[model samples]
Target chain A: MSTADRRRLLGPIDASPLYSDITPKVHSSVGEAGKSDKEVRKVFIKTGLVSNASGSSYIEASNIIVEVSVFGPRPIRGSFTDRASFSVECKFLPYLKQPQEDLFRGDTHANNNGRQGLTEVEHKISQYVETAFLPCIILEKYPKSTIDVFITVISTGNTTAPSSILNLTNWIVNCSSLALIDSGIEIKDIVTSGHIKYLQSEQRLIVDPLENEEREDALDCLVSFESLKNDEIVGLWIDGNQKLLTEELLSKFIKECSSMSEKIRANFNNYLLKLCEN
Target chain B: MQEVDQISFPPEVLSRIAPDLSLERHLKLGLRPCLRSFSEFKPIAVSSPALEDEPNLVGSSIVSHGQTKVICGISIGVVEAKNQSDTLNQNETNSQDSKSDGEYDAEPVYPVVDIARGRTGAPTEEEMILSQRLYEWVLQSKIIPASALLTNPGVAIANQTSSSQGSSADVTILYPEDSDMPDLFSRVKPYKFVLYVHLKVFGRSGPLFDPCHAALIGALKNTRLPRIYVPDSSIYSIKIPIRSRGNFGHRVKETRIFIDENQDLSNPLQLNKDNIGGASNYGLYDLSPGSTSMDVDPNVIILADLEGDAEEAECMSKLNLIYNPNKKSINNISYSGGGMVLTKDTLKQCFKLAKKRAENTQ
Candidate 1:
């Protein structure tokens, strides 16, 4: 074929096909009829799973599973005289599909231009993890060194639903904290994160939201708190159109997330106690 | 008319206008959006070895100032001084026979800084700048004297003797068992160490240089290197084979130094107190016993650590000074942005403030 004809054959892409049309039938209630709204999914945590890493943890809840590994307080080869460096890396398994574009449509500007290697979602999640855990870690304790946290999503719930990203981020934060603790790194307090979606239509806030329940039109906020402290928020990430959100609604959502965080903290403490016994 | 209609302003242009107007309004009112004063700094707390439970680390510290938090960790590793001498020989031969002072003089310690913030594949520009500045400040200030890190007294003497006897003697000394005088190799050889500094800053507080500086200083002060003893010749004789690509297939045999882990850690470097009384030896500052009165007006206000609104103001004058209270001298001074031309009297005030803060923290 002629070069021009071959080039013309590869025409400008007009549209891409949807990955799946069979949206898992939305369940009106995930648990018992009235209990679904108040109930959060049970969290399962396991640590020291990765043999080579200095510390590692795996977290599972509902259809989501995340693994995090902590390495170092090892020497780094640059000219940093004062303190140890801390970094976070996040990756999603290839089997998992990317979140629907519509969910992140309003936040196009938020994608940093300089992050060339990471997908937009991976970059966002890693940044969130770094910011949330930064306050809890005693970085200055190791000078001229680096501590790296690597997080991988083994599996995730259906991504077509809007809440998948939020769920993934929350699990990453929790999993990383366990891994850091496992590595015997000195931390100020355990960090527990929770995701909440505000359903404006029903005027209800859903804590630890499931994928099918996340309404695209609703506002969502993911918050992480230092559990031992007085609910001092270490990291917060909000999504959805701000124009659709009111100050009162945002405050109410925050309060709901804060309360939900307490429950998650209790679960973490129980897990730690069990870990110590062994 | 058609062209003008088609020229829609980019969204970024419209977004930038709003924040600029708000910032300008706040600046005019002499108020920061965070409600902090122009001269006021965020609260700062420095904890040495920030994590009490991690006893394995050599040195660690956490510095939280305002909304910004930074953690610093220090790790040390030994590298053979022989490899350094090879490079020194090349450099000297290339430079027309310049004096080859020992390995330490030929290759100065270069600490690495790795900042993990946000999710970019490569190191961010801010990380690079902060790392460079911290490295420069530490070296220029001579915070830790190079001599203080010499492996051990025995190693230092052996190194001096071998260098004086030429390259053949150096080889014989390193592998004394091969020579007739096996007894000479009985003592352990001293080695040089490279210190690695890692810093992780949380929150996107502007101007990280100051917080990182404070955090690093705290970690260095708390650092205690372990006392390592050289193992016996039997251990050295057990050579590990290393593959090498030669015209004929070959394996290179090398001796390895074993560290005695049972030995106790050496005393902390004590950078703050080492040169306090004998400050004239270093010559960086002329703060001798009777030289407090300044011939030059040192009238700058050096803000040791700046954070929050004061950092964001961008226009306010800020100076970062590293003060050595024990020596009663200013080690290093750096500043950024514009306004408030500093007189010598202002510089003196800055030194006084830095000294006071350093003393209070100690």
Candidate 2:
């Protein structure tokens, strides 16, 4: 019983790619020269993009582009439950190459087929977003229902930073928060996340760092918070070598991450205020 | 009697319906559902290199943490280096850490984790997440050196002077540093061994990440890669029809590599032992103000080495740390606060306990 895709035609094995003589244009990096590391790249977020979905949001920050749609609070066909069941599914465009994907996910043979199940990177991102939102959403309000979040990654940016996924996760969390709000879901508070890269040797923390050099060892941390709930952390992910970690260093990461989250929260508030005006 | 049955149920029943209440009851008794203390961890038992004897496996390990068992086996494959200088240049520019110093290169292992739950289909979400995280951590830690898997390809030469003229050809191997190139060496392409890790978990209990990581490092410590070689006549050019709009035909040269069957000629895989660390998981649970009989001011308790289904479902706020004892350093930390807020004190406590556990394991 062969399960291979028979409908879709695969390219010839010996076919050579058509070459273009025009040289590729390199886009300037998000953080231009002389820009302060404390400042983050300008983000463009808009909600209600998908007409068919209950709620949708499209966010573009630098080269990373993400679209999230929220569906549910709709009735389920299964047995009755006390609280709404929540699930998140994330997928990247078949052609979109994830950052350092080769190192983490070596099986590129199955990449050409669009019908394949979610890759490891997509599953991981989905789990992170799901974990972050589970505590914030008041699922009990919509009993015997289900809430599903579907995220589509259009582009993952060209940054080679090891923390690129964390950056993408940060944006996805924020966009999902907006989609949830637009759906009129009864969430406790808005969940906004912040990502930072900490350089051990330089003793510096770059808020919303977009790029990482291979020569420099950095501690990348992403923290999500529901600010209204006593600034409680809803989710957290930290990556890098632990040898550079100290009690003070860990404390600093949290403090910096929360501050960054606070800034994003202010931006969201302004956006929502304008949304009300219209 | 019917009302009484509804009010009070069995321990197992209660654990399933209301896991939080069940956990609180256990905590009041100064023990967990697994019968271990709040700070106690399940001791790890590693199998005595039994899988190392398998001919197909380059290295393998079976680790049991209490009731949970994880089996990890590594296999090898050879890949031709597309451009040798490109790899060398990247290594030169990226040299920073003492573990992955510019002199040697480091690559990640391809890992696939399968937890036997009596079901066979696509990998579960847990398996996919764990496998991905494991791969990322291995690369970030820079434990596996590329030089260790870099093969010294042997070139076969015909023994014309020997009486047995049609017998096996004499092979000459070239090491990485060898610069004295013969005419045949120019055609010889550099090759590297890729390690594929297969992890199988049984008696799955609690968070599988910690034990899965332990088993992988355990297996990697014993890996010995076999020598590989390419015959002098391995490289051949063939013309294939190009179906593109601009091209008519193209010629491609390919090489076929083979592994040496002689067991004694293998070399142990070099690993950055100092950077290798074991993972520990802790769940933070907040005591409902006055649930406990004892008056503890700081109600948040960090439970070490989480086990069983009740604790996993109840404790949404988790702290996972990978600590290296030799350097007394932390390699990775993933803490998610589902309910309880992670205070500085709680974070420090987890690090302290994780470091202690790592040191004791060594």
Candidate 3:
């Protein structure tokens, strides 16, 4: 059967811990899991968008599109005297769940019958970005300040997993940094992000999640890799109850995040070179 | 005046730029030790450090500047010697000759120059050499105050004074009347600290050459990290690859710092104090710095690249850098990928040209 048909028969893909078919989600786990035809997806960089921003770009993967705009290092607005400041705001459509109908409604993309607090999802992003990405920046010079970044998920497709959000943001931030430069803004480090999800029962690891599998997930986590040399994990987003998360899952997630982050980093550099041409 | 075509240096020659370029290119110049022009690097686009509570300045989205450009933002931070910490960070370093705190109880290490240079090519031997030279100058110098870098005493200590500013990060310094100022631990003196010597290289690879020779002149001519503190006095010798007909250590004289007539510095290069900015075609430098003599003559010599009329090459020259007592004449000679060091004459010339250009542009 074709990929779409197989997923359809898998019955909308739910996290294994909650709904234990433990088989379909297992496909994503084995990734190179001995399946002769399994293929890995990639993230691509887009430039020349987000005019209001100093630096901006978009990263698109299967079922996910993240656009990031980089602005200022300009004399920050508040009491930022000697140093710089960064502010991050992430928003999902109010109806983040029920991805299918979630896309049908207004800009808010009503889903979950207009339920599921977006604040939780957005907070994960903010916390992850602040921890993983900030240290990579030279905070000493830009003292007493904030550099603000606002991310809004304009569209929600079926299954925008936590991993997808982290990967997309890393991709977006990297592209946005280039965008920031196109606009003549300064940058301290070149940081990228990635995420991995673990299925508790089957020990299945999903690289980037779509809405369907994520909704079914028992435990989900997000990691942002910030530095190139250190391969440092700058941000971490752990969803579901922490106790439900296992050691095997954490190890698998970190390994996958590191490897994928490197792949995406190469692409980001290539994009920057294209930017330099003009 | 035909807008001279770009000059290119041999790949083997360019490697002298440390961690600035990758290796294979270093093979082109044969990994010879020398310096290149700042503009000569491949394109370099760097962003300022990201601030917490602010958007990330660190992103994979790089602002690409076409061509290989190495960017060095040379920031200067000065604080009194008494307030810094004694230990230095891993990157903090100075020349081998720096005076130790052990030798003299309180001698201030002069402001050392640290360079954080970046470029497209993997780091070359020359880049490493220059980085080391600049590193040693700061790590082992007598100018920086070790006391200022100390944030806590083994254990994290809160500031005795409260943050009347009412901010979460506010830090206040206080000393009681009975406090002994002589205690080296006190953190009050305004120590003059030169944080890091940021260097950037642009353009493709070439032979050993002078980088600061142009940008310093241009910024002076055209318009214009943290860690331990050190002085410039302690450097005994600098390590550099010898590029000569015979491969061996050759003796090249010292170069000194350039001080303009307008400088409010305690002391400066006594030679031609009136001579401001001049000399563009040559790579001149102030090797020695102190109150007694100006622009110290660092006897440690190496090759430098010079670009003019589309021809780029390195030069080795004999000169007194420490406040030249003899301002009589300069010996001009030609050698394989070598020429004269950045003499006072060349500097004065660049300054003149840059000043004139700045005026016309304005």
Candidate 4:
């Protein structure tokens, strides 16, 4: 028996994990493949929900539910910087199973040793969101401060595939931008993102593909853009299975994402217009 | 700084500076800071069983209540009885012990709660309290029947006596109850399995007990106990010389057991399903006179599934209830009226709401 933990109650020391005799059940396909390539799920966006935060926004797109809260430009007691330092933290509800968690949950080979810190998935999303909004936010205006964006994934709609993350990240980026606008932060332009999947077998692209339609050979691409700044790309992330990348194919993928971004920008424009009128 | 401080602060700023006042203002509008109304619980989603193929896990579940999520995984361990003679009268002694203890024949699982707050050290007070409470409640409810944890061991032998001495290629496993080996385990002591629950909370936005309990119950409901057996081999002793340590050789006895790799022999762990109930939490806040539409007597409002800092910190009186609809019974109720009085009517209301939640979860 191992020594007891003085501070906490630790269970038995001689216990071993019980083995199972039954085979796992195979899940049936959810039939999301029938969704049209050009169609996107209905999106709902609301701003200023968290009463205590400087600014907040909640978004529900497809099966994913996300909330973003911005707290910052508040004073810091440490060393000062000429421009505000920006950071993004993305966290999923512990029970909201991550996409392809079984394949990629732990960074090392520790497997089920109980991961610490942010999983690779959360870190990548936070990094991308931060990079996407870095240029849009006028960080120089708020000198010697920090602007922090906290993204909380409320649900992933029970998706288990890895490709669903691209679609989810796209929504998170858009929601964060709305939260920034709500915070009344000085920014150069609103940043919006789009996701598309290229199917190798079909030789076609599906914009805003559903989770069920993801295939091992499909190429998933997510791009964030500042539409007002001549559609300049601020962030780009691509996940490919086995397809060889060419310059022409990459540009084609970018073009599809930019068009999707345009559509999202138009919707945001109308929503902002209604807010101004109200 | 002077000019900014002189003007009245924004509503968000006021919430931070004076949460009590801000909460009262929102309650007047029939909404909490998280935009939830009184008596409305955050909807919860329970994912299917998880980590089924994990070698060290018997069962796992993930449950999400609003923005908070709790993942629970149950691993198992085995311990032998200290007294080798106890196996003969284990059942009778267990009942007698229960009678003397004034409790049922149930076992509480060991649970460890790790809430990720971007820091690492000993468990925080909130985690410890939640874990202790869960352990106590599980025992009080008698959800895990102790009898279900008793394990039976089998032994494997070569079918052919000649092959057993030679290549040993024809090994045949025989359980204690097998007709060909009725007396195989007559002198062996009985072993019991122990369940250890690991709960990890992420993005916690409010009180954690309710969600943690849900995840625990879900994982237990699907738990399956594996078959373990003792090896049919000699208990040979080996002596190892330790020249470097300058010590005499010590004898090491071999008494290791093995878990059956064949999953077909595994059995679903039996749980007292009727005692398992949905847990709902309520915060009692007084809508004082002249607040909202109440102008006379102080009205007490019960908010279900408390969320956000303002409610968690400002709500002085709290109640946690677990109701089982199948049994039409209230399994547990924990109330802490922090310097506040709770009327009988408020308790009755909470029970009613608890029953409704139980029925919905069922």
Candidate 5:
């Protein structure tokens, strides 16, 4: 499609394959395939909120700021298997006393070691990461040891922005890279994630939902993408309670994945080249 | 100079005022302009007491960073307990005996009770810490002779007396030392006290006075009480002064303004508040008079660290301090708040009135 046609399809900031609006400030950051940001004329569909991780990018859509830091590909020590292991620990500042009483008791204690604040929101974000991102990254090359990734979501900004998955994905990658730097690790590629929320009120599709919209809107979908050599699922998420999805909408969410994947892969490849040169 | 007995400001420290004065001299030498020539920085002679006042008391007076009218006074009150008397038992209260960090001794039950009887505002954090420090100091030291805590049999300081389970030192007899040990023991000497201190910040009537120094001054004047110092014992003590003036303006900092009787005040410790500077502290001359000095130790006085312009320009202004602790550099200025440091004539009048009152009491 031409630039004008793509613009028409995306329709103002509110038009999307999801419910929340794709904010101009957030959308412009993602690069369009076969064309740079300026060259592609800044399409409304690009994952602009995706944060640059060590090797990964986390593009947020709902009310959260997720940063992913990736580490390792460092030499393994003990186990000699063809697979590598990784772990993630998330933390929140202590002073933020959450209001809801029910949100803290019983089941909440399982994940909480008293005050090591991996808050409820982090729990949701991490669930997606463990389910999606871990499968794609090749661990077999460095079999024995562990690669630690820390995903921190500083603020969700009133639940409007697709800040959760976006920033979580961002920090996991960022901290992982820092860990890798500390451990002297190298990697082939980075990972990235994107999200879209279904807004029932406006009948409009929004790419990245602000915190307010997430509170007000009905349904949302999040998808994370990493470059795939073969047709295997890697680092990604497909979170949506959007029941009545047209075939067209599903295709758009999936198709949008490829373009995001290519950008992430290019970004990682370029970053690796720069790092190796340095 | 007397042999080393207690910590005090050095002569050079006295010379810091240029009109070098000892504690006695500060009071008797009268006031002279500081070499700084800022009348507020004026120094007076000071020399500790030779007469036995409050027995076994230790006291000191350090001119504060401010010469304001602010004064801190400490007085000890003796009360006979109805149940557990004051801590005079030979029993050592150690951390090993502590069930937990915050728990008090169970037998004696020395409640670190605070009396708020005629007070207005809630007590400040500093005041609480000061009292707690006193409590710990008492718990940790042997200064207060355990004998004074002896209870008179069958007598307690209650309005009515109960025949059984009366308030006495509940001595638990363990094995009775082959069953011949006495069940009750009495003190050879008697003393009971609760130290009540008042740090009065007179509404800025006199020159700018450092509360810390005034606190020391308060301690110095307090030496009118009797103190004890055994003959031939080397006096190792510290004089702490709260540092108020600094780059940040009011960050409350305190340094041990250590003083020694024989030593010059030229060089003394600059202790960081809370004893952070460590084991290297200063010493002083033993000021205890005669045989009483053998049994009595000077009562302790710790000054609150100096405060900044926030307390002066702003905080004190709110209190209606007539003189500003701000602007004027802290020195020897006399303040009039609390009415003690009015102009010279008025001050003389107030002193005369106090003297008359003392005469009446006598």
Candidate 6:
């Protein structure tokens, strides 16, 4: 059938309404286990999860789970002779509630309208990871080739809470780093990420705040640091009600978040040693 | 390790390899395979008021340069902002009312863009990115002034006159008080319009943004909004009589308005000239009072449109500039891709060329 005839055969298309649901109530100020605000959640990491992939790693923190697979140093079709091209693809299972649309108000423009396999949030996440990791990779050694990193958020905690998304993103970065290392690719250093939240109500700073403990108005910052590069921050994303934060407070939060990354980096190194022994 | 054996080079490997060698050879000579200079743009042909037989579309255009072709069509609809009470209840439940502040902010009219590449089923990442970039560029560049989409332009004129006493040059030309003008001043309620831009790219050009932008500009230039007559009472209560012309029908209740497909397509809202007196030649709508006119510097050359081959070559770094044809100044400038640092002189030349191109096309 002709395109128009096919369209006519189908009923009137009701493009899904942009505003799908109202923001749910913030359930509580404490987490499920009544975890303290300062206590960082324990992270579980596994390497070589995908035998077929060049390198693969899976990480779980509380209810958040992410898996990363790395492939290549394989020949690239184009004339990328000077350096290797890097590409990242991030996907969230359809069943998960994608709250990313709500965080950035008026994201009506970003909606793909069920057009792309990857949602808008997935695109942004992929782009973010690609940018953050591009500087560290030794691309010149793999000239005319490409490295592909695939990240999958198998499960995420508290989709409604904005902090959970940040937490999930941090886990993805950490997992990808482990996957790249396991792949035996030439690299700079291991990268670890951490998130810190500034609670406005109590005027307190919480490192690695749980989903429930994330205040709607709290200032949240997520920073990724290179473990061996003197804790140099490779990526930083900050968002919240900016009007509530002062210059001093914002910088202070960054400092604390950067320091928190040191701990994550050390733990990641210990995990790497454990994996090698096994 | 087993999956590695199954992996194969993409089918385009041969085509890509040949082009890279030739593209580099030509770049050394400062010429493209098409024999165009580094700064020269490919021949661009834009057909506006296209698809006139299709009554549903308000404006449509076809833009082509070399092998790249893009078709842009615009559809207009009236949408009411969601009720405040529903959000207020949600806010009350949350206790922290700050999150609801977004509701009070002016509702922006988001233009939906659908790009159809070779793939039919789902939108590719490239398409999504292009749509988003187009949306942002349109808004950030203020290409379509918010005031242009008003239900009643007469109110805007009155507000302009009262706000700025003697600086009435812009408003007088936009809404001329003439016999042919519709008596929309009697309506107290104001309405906003949503534009859905449907773009279809025929071939896989290196970058689709430039062509899409030009086609959108051409299509928007060709667009004509209809004069809506809102009835008193709930729109649902009134049964709209089907009409033959342009699809335009609307009904208004206490706070809600409903529109049907009964528009007068014959009488469309004009973009180049005033509909009433047909005297003033103000291209598009007038600039709001107190807005500064953009100044174009005349030194550099602006590549108006890039062809497929040129774009694939050394044109790694691209700057897309949107200009106001009437004011002779740039409305917005966006930079994409990364390579080759542009100098101040080159930047100025780009804007000058953009302004020149806008004038020629309009």
lDDT of each: 0.57, 0.72, 0.37, 0.75, 0.32, 0.57
lDDT of 3 by residue, A141-187 (tens): 55664555645443333344444455445544554454444545445
Instruction: For candidate 3, report its TM-score.
Output: 0.33
RMSD in Å for all candidates: 22.1, 25.0, 25.6, 9.0, 30.5, 23.5
Q: Candidate 1's error at B116, in angstroms?
A: 3.6
Q: What is each candidate's DockQ, to 2 decimals?
A: 0.02, 0.01, 0.02, 0.14, 0.00, 0.01
Poorly placed runs, candidate 2 (over 4 Å)? A1-278, B1-7, B52-56, B82-105, B158-181, B234-254, B289-297
Alpha-carbon DockQ of candidate 4: 0.14
- Writing each residue's lDDT as its tens digit, candidate 5 over B1-362 gives 86988756676565444332343243233322222210121222223322111111223332223333223333322333433433333244432333233333321101111211112234445344434443343343222333332222211122123444433232121121233333322321222223333333322212222233234333533333221111110111223343454634444322111111111211111111121100000001122223233232342110011122211221121110111122221111222123111234433333333233222221
Best by TM-score: 4
What TM-score does the first chain of candidate 1 have? 0.81
The share of true interface contacts that also appear in candidate 5 amounts to 0.00
TM-score of each: 0.45, 0.51, 0.33, 0.60, 0.31, 0.42
lDDT of 3 by residue, B91-206 (tens): 24222213343332222211111122211123456555545433332333222333322222111123336554333233222222323543533432322222323233423333
> Local error of candidate 4 at B13, Å?
8.4
Q: What is the descending lDDT order?
A: 4, 2, 1, 6, 3, 5
Model 6 / residue B224 / CA error / Å = 50
Local error of candidate 5 at B286, Å?
39
- RMSD of candidate 4 to the truth, in angstroms, is 9.0
Candidate scoring better on DockQ of 1 and 4: 4
Residue A238 C-alpha lDDT in model 5: 41
Residue range A112-191, candidate 1, lDDT tens digits: 11112556788889999999989888888988988999887645654445455876798788889889999998889999
Point to the candidate with the largest DockQ: 4
Q: Write the per-residue lDDT of candidate 4 for residues B5-97, one digit (tens) a residue.
A: 566779999999999999999999988888877988899888854343344466788898887767787766677754444555657766675
Lowest summed lDDT across 10 adjacent residues in model 5 chain B is found at B275-284
